[model samples]
Target: MATLICEASGDWEKAKCVIKDCGSLKSVSDGSVSLDSSATTFGSTATVSCSVGYVPKAEKITCKESGVWEEAQCIIKDCGSLPSISDGSVRLDSTATTFGSTATVSCNIGYDPSVATIRCQASGAWDIAACTIKDCGTLPSISDGSMRLDSTTTTFGSTATVSCNIGYDPSVATIRCQASGAWDLAACTIKDCGTLPSISDGSVRLDSTTTTFGSTATVSCNVGYDPSVATIRCQASGAWDLAACTIKDCGTLPSISDGSVRLDSTTTTFGSTATVSCNVGYDPSVATIRCQASGAWDLAACTIKDCGTLPSISDGSMRLDSTTTTFGSTATVSYNVGYDPSVATIRCQASGAWDLAACTIKDCGTLPSISDGSVRLDSTTTTFGSTATVSCNVGYDPSVATIRCQASGAWDLAACTIKDCGTLPSISDGSVRLDSTTTTFGSTATVSCNVGYDPSVATIRCQASGAWDLAACTIKDCGTLPSISDGSMRLDSTTTTFGSTATVSCNVGYDPSVATIRCQASGAWDLAACTIKDCGTLPSISDGSVRLDSTTTTFGSTATVSCNVGYDPSVATIRCQASGAWD
Candidate 1:
């Protein structure tokens, strides 16, 4: 047997004998641990003891030779009964009240809780708390009134009474605190006085239909009457201030020079009228006067018998016979250069009014006509400053485009003259002809081009100025002809002009269906283009072979016939013709 060497570990280092121990047990929350023997070595035993309201996981544990104690721990104990509340009940989150458990308190309708929830602590006890009644803030104030609280406490279900001051009424007599911790609506309003006061010969207007305090009433008298006070207020006592309206009176009518007064009514009180009349040719300032609401009569007066100066006439002058504009006065009238007067004199009428004369604009006769043109008037009447528009013939123009009627009853001198576009411009291959004998304004001319030639413009006109509007005649020629495939073309004329012709000729293996084409007046060939004529493929002959001179069998293409061994064709060779046939 081999001798074994042993080494001490964990709390047994350097000891004479191997001494094992379950190192001091870790303390458990709310619990304690104690060993059976003071010395902790192999086979030692220990007991787990928990604090009040706590329990141990295992009652006893032993230490092993390895210096380790058996697994042991302390757990939280059950907490008995939930917390109490004054005005509430408890609601547990779960039936279990072990560690980390929670419970909530619900207050009665009008109560509240101090804390929302109570939790079971690690000590196996619930946190201390209670529920109490809720409180509401201060009472609401009333406008124009006083409020008195009925209950000493401002909690839910509390109430207050309202009292309005003098001249005001309470909207509600009582108010209460709501469960939401707020007061009900409460208010007071000013008192209202009934209808406004009535008055004789006048009317009263109130600021509002309701005659409440601070309301105003305006007093207005009827015609010919005056009010003692214009406005009054409703007093706090619910009554309007005193006001009165009385009839107005005016004194006697006044006298006027050169005038006589006649009273329309017997009495001179309000609304009385008086008429004033002046001597012949004299006028009263006012026809009648009446007693006004201000307790006085309106002014009445009469002055000298004369008419005011005559109003000035447009484009005319007037001279008064005398310095005064009295009756029987006369004034002479004179017209401006372009004006005419209806009458030569103006007379003052007996009614103290002037008989005015009117001045009219002078009229000019119809406009004069031009040799080869016409004129049209722009205005309905031929009065001064009116204008006439001149229009010339196709070959003429106006010397002066417009003319006006003079102020002296004459028309302005204007005419449409014949244009003198000197001689017609010459053209290379064309000739021009004058339609009129003279080359003045309104003259017309025509241009003619020889065959195969064209003029830029067919006609010419003498412009508004002395010069004529003319254009040169250019030579007319057709554009290039379309190309011919496998063929060539030859022009009948040197230039491709109208009536010109082109002839098409095909190569040895092609032919043209239409040998010739003509150039049209539109500067294009009558035919689109020339094409080669095809004779179709050669016929197959039995026992004989055929050889073609070219790949194509069109137009002049040829084919050689041969005998195979002992066979011979009817014809030795064949040729493609221009008529789309083989011969």
Candidate 2:
């Protein structure tokens, strides 16, 4: 028996082992190696193999009993050359391919490889599919806009552009196709501007509420105000253009001659008014001056005025205080003795007329004498509208105290008469007496009544109508006498005249309490002697009791009697008569 020991050399040192040589073995190259042990030494065989992607052909060797080995040869299996691909290319480890060899595939720019790697097979061919061009999916859709491309087919390194409609813009300008089989997309958005600016004393009007680029706004003011700016524009940078709207103002008002002006406000403004007023003795030509929209005031003026000539007077000399009869001028007039003018002075008015009425002269006659009174005048010679004072003697009085001169050239004597009294009148039942023989106005007369008569009025007087006021003295009469119980009276006469006396007497069996009565001057009777006397107590009874009807035994009273048990009665009843006695 022969033994074989295989040793590794060169790049195949890891596969070194003992084996028996088979004469039919071939070569190996970086792949699996095998041995045919049936034809080799028993229980001492060795083989060599190659790794993946390499072919191996083992060497045929012999082993001897003396522990020595013979050298052998190894060969590699061969595979064909690599094939070409459309729009692609292949790369191989060597130009001459072998078993278990590999080849890589790749595409051109903007292209992708379908198979990345391949290997050589034992049938002398490559284990790989054909390479194809890469494809990027369809381009993404853009919002509010659209994308522009050369073709619908999307490939690697291909570019597309994005665009927006009116009032819109794109987020990005352009996009490119990638090797990852996808295309990048850029979005689109709407363009906008910021809020609009505000204006003072005015308002803005816009075409629409939306504030955007290239928009316009118009400004306007209130009724009494005007705007400084009329229009404004919106800018592209999301902001509005600079604008200022203010109130319009007019300048100071003009001065007016001979007049003063009053303004609504210190500062002149649109629609304001200035009122013009003239001083004393002047007038305004225009009433008001108003501010207009053109920043100007209405024209106004003031003017002066004058009066005409003065009035003339009859029977009086006139004098002018000023050279001309202009406004605020005066004039005077004077009259002769015993004559007076109706007006004393005259003045000129601003309405071109004199302030004095027509003046006339008049005279007054001589003063009149009084009978029992004296008259005194303000002047010895009197004129119209003059006054005089009148007085009477110490015991007399005048009907009127003062008098005046009339327009008829005579004094007024209607209230200038002197007062006097006439003879005293007689009184009935009385004598009239006077203090003095001279009986005039305000004189009084005293009266004396006769005996037993009274005077109705105590005095009499003389009146200004020349009539005497008479007074009466009346005869006095007394009233009827008072009645006395159980008595009788007799008068001297039926008429109860003053100074008349009456006699009184009680009834039978009664005494007289008063003797006589008299009448007084006051129409009343004297009651001192008009009383009646009372009767004494009734007689007492012993056997039979007595019961008096009245408490006492006065006039017109009665008593009753009763007997005890079967005794005879002395009297049943007894009466007290008007004479104060019991019957």
Candidate 3:
């Protein structure tokens, strides 16, 4: 083989060898050459070259001119990169290595340490997509064994267990754990009745209940708890209910039925009095009574006693008080008892109940009768709702009374001065108002039209204050003007009709009083007109004077007359005398 001729130098000898011209070329004519490719070799230092797009593997290759070309070793290299760790936050999880070296992942403490060590894949990425997370086993409950998880999830459910701290009691909470594998966290609610439970004083409860952790558990009280206001509940988790029921409303005994009884109040208060009365044929044993501590009351237990023994005012009864009353009267019996206005009871005896109906109650005298307007009293002891109907002769307010009936069964007169005015009314014409100082159960009210009067629109009415709500006066007394019957003459009905009427009588105990009568035009009947003769004018009534029965008349009578009530008979008859003239 001949020596090769070199053309280039520097880095490596600029060499261009042609093995075809010289067989098995062994050497080059330049500096020593190195084999470019691993597949070639030469006997001595020879010029070598690498293929296009490839660099010599050894930086320097050799080729020999031996009539055979020296091989130029070439190799493809991979791009360099960093060893990736599973957690990018912990980039240095593996030892440093070459471009294609493999890396693995590791975890810090508190962690499973070896959950899933990530592997650096061929893509130079430590992908954790293939790793699985391990979850904690079902946690045991901390509260009473009543807690259960709905599902093994990291959330809550509809129902939950509410546990009170060691020293607490709570009502059943509003959450629970179902069969789903989830956690139900319920807010703990504690309840405790500040006072004991009860019943009588409206203070106790009969069947109060309580609850505990969410489970099947119930709470209850004895016959009556000291605190009726306290509330109790039960739990579904079988745990004691935690919350003590709070006071909501007072428990009330069923209402008692007596004569038109009126209960004093509708408040949460207990032991308020309710007075009872009877209708026409009915009779109440007692009246003017107060409610007992047990919410029970006696009828007509205030003034006169019907115990079959001598009556005494001071009994252990709650109704007995320093008030006047009138019991059954025999007229002849004197020393029995005085007129006890406090005696609230005026009812028929049991056997006589259906016989003679109860007499009409005078707001100031007796309870109203079947002939009179209706009455609605509250509880046998309570006067709050006590009401009486004093029907004017006619066309007057039925709710008006010369006096009103009180829980005490006492007739009360209007407090206003006698100016033909009715009860003091609270007018809300947005302007008109009453300027009178009246205070009392039956005090009357006086009102005038708005300062700027509107004659055609003057309307007035009085109502009771401090009532459960507002209520118009009961048993308005006879109006200044009398309402003539349909066929009768009238002075004046004077005011709005309250289904009231009045009974006028002449001076003669047996004589009938003649005056204009009125009624609410409704069921109001002028019972005020008696069944017989009326007395004549004041100055000329001869004793024992007899006239036709025209002086006395029934309701709805058509008679022209002008006469005051209770006058001696100048000429007795059914017709009323005009002024001093009797025709």
Candidate 4:
């Protein structure tokens, strides 16, 4: 030992230089520290290391002369940074780059990662992970449509063009592959044009069962009709082109001789009818004709008319200039002996009818007027052979009973004359009064009796025989005078005629009511029966009482008076006199 111990104190001292040692190291956060050697002596070296997933700040620590190892610490490790993906991001367990750290790779939607997670290597480097774009499968087939891809690959953002097949519509023009690895919907629908317009009085025929675009249709007219258009087309816009069908027209109708036509409708189209009207003397062969499909009207005609024989007129006959009764014939009218013709001639008209002609009786002028008479006609009109009767008025006579009208329109001579009556006859004991100065038929004579006579008839009238009727007056005679109960009569005339009177005398003790009764023209005596005479009661005396000889104080009755105690009566007895006086 080339030790310097020989020079040191001779005691062979064992003192020697000791190596510096370092103490245990602190543990690392989220990791642990380790050493290559457990020695912590000065001048000795130890390797500094971290636990799993961790790393040391220094490689090794050596014991220094100061007995302190060099400053060294173990901390969490960090993977520097994960490798970036094309469309992804990375997340680490911690911000460490040393060992045991893991990084997770998250691919963006529609992308795929090479690995889900990567670890930091023990050498302080991170494992590699990557992201790649996802692939979407091929697009599905679209109904009623076809598809065309821009590229054969179907990745995100890839697009495909779409088109509808025949009779269909592609609602979408193109579809894209989405980030979710699916393609956009291809909305394809069947093409359609709604119902077509109907043809009026016509029909429409379609080429195909469907009314879709590109379909064709034919337009046709019904019987008796014509179409304006023959066909129509469906447009790409799912609509049909404008078209219409209309009716056919027939030309104007032909003219018929002696007749005219009238159309049933305003148009001369097929199925229309026209009525025929003939002229006055013409007859139509047919009533109506119809328009045909051949653009013309059916045949029609008119013919001359035939009129029947003329009718017979009462009391007259008709003579024809021509024997034929057809149109344009002429006739003449003739009447009987006393009749006349209204018209001389008549002609047949084109309407199968004859012009009017009449035979009428001859008319006579008014009859001559008479002084006081009138004439009565048997018929309303003064025609030929008519009769008229002449009548006299109240005071006149007719010269003729009946007269007739002559063929020369003259009436027979007839006259009305005043009636005549003979002189009025005298009436016995009576006078006559005439109504008028002249004594004509219907004259009146009124008769009146004398003082003592009565008229048998009061009036007389002149007769149609031209004579005055006879009248007589009779003497008014009264019957026997009425007898009174107790009286007698003395008549001046024995016959008791009108104006005669009788003297009425009461019987004994009775007095006549009237001195005389007269006979009146009414055949009755103007006298009442004789009544008995009555005397009233006697007057009272100054102081006496009276006594009656009979119960009644009538004619020939007596009365007696008695005086009062000191009274005296002028007379003691009294008698009622016939004159109703007291005696």
Candidate 5:
């Protein structure tokens, strides 16, 4: 019968035998063959088990009766634990996950320690770790809304009110704090907000105060504005401040948009055209025409250098009759310097058979010729397209002249015809039409641009005769591009093939967009210059440029990039943009 060869054979090679029947014995627990000093053969059995956390050798055991050594089997283990996270948290319970047990963690209510992560071990013990995370936010500031808030802001999550410091109306008059700790508006609305008071800061509100003669409150005003009516605290302050019309702003003056006027008085001269229209009641057709500046009007025809054409003589003025006068007949009176404003005078004859012309050719004087200057005519009788050339006796470039004359036997008074034409008007994208042959200061010189040229660039002004000034123009339409989305990538791979997930995005912040771009088909490559942005306000550059590969919420970070010849970073140098947006 077969007997037990070796109960447990691990160390010694030889074993004792209680030999029996036809077969041999084998061990599953731990097995091995053994050899004795007597060189005798014996049946043996070997059994084996492995270290603690490791799986032991397989089920079979090896035994050699004829003195041969059998092979051994076992495997080592590496099973790693939980990994570290970006938030500084750690996890360890990966072992014994075999049949799988559950794992758990917690952040004590009060201890709000950043993170609390844990994993279950083979022994069922849980290993927990702590980590830290940061929170980001903004400051209490007004945006481009109903409030003209100061862009200056404190930190994120603060508060502010709506009051334009000075010279501005509060777009929104009130504001409140929000949950995010930042200042926001529950409701924004318009109130009786006039422009900023023309007073110093910190001044109290005078809305409830009454208006009295001499009584006044300091006030602040907006740009381009000034007090048209003085505020006076007359009797005990009664009604709110009130304003009234004063004649000081009105006179023989041209009506400036019916109320607002440039206070420079008596500026009208002969040929100075100003329209006459009265308020609703006053009949404009029956209104008396007079010189705006001096109140001196032409009872006779006002003098002009050379009426581009003959002045259309109206009623009760000079006429070209024999006993009447022939316009350019015998003594034609003309002035060449410092002339009086045009005025009409009635020549009371013995027989009141009224003869009317702009002015009398007989009361006129001889015209003193001028070169590059004006020749004021005494009568309304005139010709068009007249030329006067002026030259200095010596060597001065003052090549200028002046001509004026008072109508009706008044001495040949020269008029205010200035001949100092400093510079010639220059032509640009557009052309110009000088109102007079003699271009003067403050003349309205209208300049137009070419079809595609931008007009808001510069205003045209005529000095004297001719001088063209250069105006820097804003960018017109040249070319532009739209925002493009090339999308993203997981890793810059061996075949940086911009795989299915690779993304690229480009959006212009300026007016002109990018044109075209291309890239070669190799692995891990840079861009082929998609397109360049046009610079300048004229060019209209897009505010935000472009982004790519990953997401980035940082400011001014450009995704389009070029690496320095030798610079290499662990992560892709090109960063994605962070759309600075929050709820």
Candidate 6:
């Protein structure tokens, strides 16, 4: 009874029983594991196995009688050798090739790798067929230039050198083929003429300093100079056309009919002026001429002078001895109506103007005297077109203040009239009288009030509107009444008009010594007449007591009294009436 036990439990009876050779062995390719007969005993053998693509290791092991089992060693399936690439090479990850392992593929310096990495599969083969080469597209064309490549083929990582043709420049010097299968080429541009040509005694204006084909340049001459050629253009050969400038000059001056010219210098150059003048009795139509850069002189002429017609005299007639009133002619003047000329004749001069000193105005004597006014002349000697102002004496005014001296040797007095405010206006309750007999404009009248009246306005004047301003007379009234002690006054009327009276009365316990007052016409009031009166001692009472409301009992005062209790009395109160005795 040799019984086997579980390794986990040291006792044989406690271990779980397992049958020998009850399960099939794990399968392997190109290899095998050994077993004892059909039934396995306490000691059985197990061998590791492998196929052609996988490597085998760790040979035989015995199975235990317990449920515990031993492992057989068989490595991963091998992919054998790496596949060859056309323009690339493969690098294996490890010495032992197996599933889930990787190999990297690379190409030459100018070539691109189509597959960077290849993995091994469980079927014992690599995932990729082979590594391929990448080609970059053809290079792009460059204007005005050509390119030189390092290699003839357009492949990845290849460089091309770019060069411009003569008189041209390249935007970029070098380009390369990128890994993305595209070739880049540098651009080229044509060269430009640096700057425009400079000009002497002139200025050059160019459309652009880059003076490429079809560029234009304009030339302008300085002051006192002119350009031979006004414009020039830059040719395609990178040169500017020829242009020149010369000094400016003006030709001979033009001749004048009746005028002579005086030039600063004999030569007629630009900016020269010629002064022209006429003979003694003549005037020049144009005063000066100037030499211009256009080789021409400004136009000018001279003409003779003649006085036109003779002037006419106002308020008189004149006769000309000659038929035409030309230069050096005379005309005689005669009086018409009441007009007369200060000078006998007038002459026309050669200066195209008449001699006006002989055109004198007639004289008018002193202005006529106004009835109640005086005249002030603008000039002491009256002449034509002169004026005078008229004024009246005090209490008088003139209808017109201004008078004019006419050409007929007389003053115009038609509109002049003396204004009189007839007999100063009468006023009620007052008398008004003027200061002078002439009651015209600008006159004053004094006013006086009656016995019981007052002059509201003291003086009045005669105005220019022919009306008299009268003084106002109003009834006189007195102001507030005078004060009095221990008494009061009452006016007969609300207002203290002249001749109005006020009555005075003393208060209780006093008498009025003076009783009345009056308002006077002079706006003053009569003296207050309210003197106080004293009363003697009060009377005594019999069979009772007496009480006086005031200490002194005068007229119009009273006292209270009471008889002894139950005693009869003649009266309960005693009065100091106006009778000067107690009642």
Q: Top lDDT: which candidate number?
A: 1
Query: Where does candidate 1 clash, by residue pair?
Result: 395-442, 395-443, 396-442, 418-440, 418-441, 419-440, 419-441
Colliding residue pairs in candidate 6: 395-440, 395-443, 396-440, 396-441, 397-440, 397-441
Q: For model 3, what is the C-alpha lDDT against the true structure? A: 0.37
Candidate 3 residue-wise lDDT at 463: 29
Candidate 6 CA-lDDT value: 0.71
lDDT of 3 by residue, 1-583 (tens): 4454554563444556543232243433222244333344443333454443234444443344543544445442332344333322223344543223333444332123342444444443443422222333354354432444345543323344444564344444434433243434443343333333223323323243432332222234332223322444333333332333222333442444434656666643334555565653344665445544444554451222232222433311123222322233211111112122333433323333211212222233444452323444333422322444344322223434433455444644422221233434343432233434634333333433332232223333332332211323233333444333322333344543444444454432233335545554332445443333333442233333332434433222223323455555442333333322334
> By the lDDT metric, which is better: model 2 or model 4?
4
| lDDT (tens digit, per residue) of candidate 5 on 1-583 | 4334443655444556653221233322223333323222333434445443334354334345545434445433333454443434343344443213333343322223343445444443444455332222342344323343334543233334564432224554554433333455433222232332434212223433533323354433332224444442333222235433211111344442222222223535422334444332122332334443333442322221111222344222233323432222222223223332144332322222222234323333345543333454434543222223333322123333423334333333232343343554555556555555545454444556654455553455543443434443232432212233432222222222222122334443212122322222222223322222322111111332233433433333334433455654333333322332210
The C-alpha lDDT values of all candidates are: 0.80, 0.68, 0.37, 0.77, 0.35, 0.71
- Which of the two, 1 or 3, has more lDDT? 1
TM-score of each: 0.42, 0.30, 0.19, 0.40, 0.21, 0.33
Candidate 1 Cα errors over 4 Å, as ranges: 1-161, 164-240, 243-248, 251-301, 308-324, 327-338, 342-345, 349-358, 363-402, 406-583
Which of 4 and 6 is the better model by lDDT? 4
Worst 10 residues of 2 by lDDT: 52-61
Model 3 Cα displacement at 392 (Å)? 66
Per residue, candidate 4 scores C-alpha lDDT tens digits across 101-194 of: 6778888877888988888876667787777776778777888778989888899888999988766778888888888788888777766777
Ranking by TM-score: 1, 4, 6, 2, 5, 3
lDDT of 2 by residue, 1-583 (tens): 4455555653433444564433433443343334545554533344665454443343334444434443333355566768777877888866668877788887776676767878777666777656555667677887788887766766777778888777666788877787666777688766665566776556778767877767887877765565666777766555666665444567888898898889966768777778898876666788778877777788888776566555665666678888987767878877765465666777776665767544443556667887767778877657777888877654456677777887767887723343556667766777888867767766778888987788777777667665667678777888677777667778977878888888887766456565877887766777643333355777777677778887867666678887788787766888777655667
> Model 6, clash count?
6
For model 2, what is the alpha-carbon lDDT of residue 355?
70
Task: Give the worst 10-residue stretch by lDDT in candidate 3.
Answer: 330-339
Give candidates' CA RMSD values in order: 13.8, 40.7, 44.4, 40.3, 43.3, 22.2
